[model samples]
Target: MKDISRNDLLTKIQEVEFACLDLNLYLDTHPKDQKALMDFNMLAEEACRLRKIYEMKYGPLTNFGFSLAKYPFNWINDPWPWEYQ
Candidate 1:
């Protein structure tokens, strides 16, 4: 995949996460939904992979993520999710 901007990648991760949560909610009410369950698992995996990529390239997406900062406190230098344009 071509390199995407940090904001775009973040948006993609957020979208996938949302989809996973929504599918999970649907599965809760319809426990026999095989298609929904498959979709949920796929989205969940995608969200996790994207989150790892984002965190590695940038900084921690959450408080408990891995930090690969090469300089002094890059975590503080990076913008909050909402602060992105």
Candidate 2:
């Protein structure tokens, strides 16, 4: 795949994640939905790939050890909840 800006990749990840979640809820109601299950799997894989690409370049996208930290611990480097932009 071609290189994408961090913001673009993040957007893609969010979109895919949202689709996955929505599909998951649908599958919960319709347990025998093969098409939905397949779609969910595809979206899930894409989300993982996008997340790996993002974290590899921009450090962890999450905290509490869900993602690996590099040498300098950059989780605190990003803007905090109350920090101004």
Candidate 3:
């Protein structure tokens, strides 16, 4: 995969996160909306995929407790939000 600049990657990640959040809020009030659920699921999957890519290349953004002990996981070396754009 091409190496995206830190700023660009961060922006994309944030956008995906926001999209997921918006979908979640909608779902909260429309739990039985199948179409909305499907759209949310797709957006959520994309957000997760992007988040994983970002985390693998940079560091963990959430505190979901993932370890990389056997895979050179450097939790301490990961960038914090302020380190990004």
The model with the greatest TM-score is 2
The alpha-carbon lDDT assigned to residue 20 of candidate 3 equals 80
Q: What are the per-residue Cα lDDT tens digits for candidate 2 across 1-85?
A: 4578767777778899899999999999998989989999999999999889878877777789789889877878855322312
Q: What is the TM-score of each candidate against the true structure?
A: 0.80, 0.86, 0.75
Q: Residue-wise lDDT of candidate 3 within 1-85, one digit each (tens)?
A: 3478767877887887798899899999999999989988888898777777777667677554652322555555635645755
RMSD of each: 2.5, 2.8, 2.5
TM-score-better candidate, 2 vs 3: 2
C-alpha lDDT of all candidate models, in order: 0.79, 0.81, 0.73
| Model 1: pairs clashing at backbone N, Cα or C within 3 Å | none
- The candidate 3 region of ten consecutive residues with least summed lDDT is 67-76
In angstroms, what RMSD does candidate 2 have relative to the true structure? 2.8
Question: By TM-score, highest first, what's the ranking?
Answer: 2, 1, 3
Error of 3 at 77 (Å): 2.1
The superposed Cα distance between candidate 3 and the true structure at residue 40, in angstroms, equals 0.7
Ranking by lDDT: 2, 1, 3
State the lDDT of candidate 1 residue by residue for 1-85, as single tens digits.
3389988998898899889889889999999999999889888888888987887787777654444455565667647756777
